[model samples]
Target: MNVTGDDVRSLALSLPETTEQFAWGMPIFKVSGKLFLTLPEGETSMAVRCPILDRDELVLAEPAKFWIAAHEAGNAWVRVYLSALDDREELTAIVTDSWRQAAPRALLDSP
Candidate 1:
């Protein structure tokens, strides 16, 4: 299945404290000003916060679906191919995980 910008926007926005912002000619999803996801390359791909170690492993394990752009190489982030995503559930999991990483302690602990 293929995921689109709308899918990204909807899933990301459903998370707590999430908001959409346009930057660098693309859509970015943030949690209280801390960005968790960005849709670039015409929304065909997304960059999300991931642990540095997990980022490398994801890219290595599934190069077709995950990667690290050169500009973000020094950061703790990974890019995911929307087209490679299996379904909305998968996207939600990914977005939620990133959201957890960016969300504040209070938000995380909130019901």
Candidate 2:
């Protein structure tokens, strides 16, 4: 199944303390006021917080699915093509991972 921006939004909002806001004329998801994900203007791809160290590897390993916007090159974020996603499960994993990165420690420790 194809993963769309709506799927990304739903998965993102499902995470604890996640909220949607608009910025740069695009939808952005935040956890406890910390940005974790963003759906750029086209909604065809999403930018998610990623460890700077892992970003290069992900992009190099799967250029079709992952990439770093030139504007975000020095930041710890990577853009993921929604159309390239394999399934909802994969989307969940990706969205949740980003949420975890931005989620507060208390939220992370919660059962």
Best candidate according to lDDT: 1
Tens digit per residue, CA lDDT, model 2, 9-97: 88888888889999999999999999999999589999998999899999999999999999999999999999999988888888898
Report how far off residue 63 is in candidate 2 (Å).
Answer: 0.4
lDDT of each: 0.93, 0.92
Residues 54-78, candidate 1, lDDT per residue (tens digit)?
A: 9999999999999999999999999
Q: Count the backbone clashes (under 3 Å) in each candidate.
A: 0, 0
Q: How many clashing pairs in candidate 1?
A: 0
In candidate 1, which residue ranges exceed 4 Å CA deviation? none
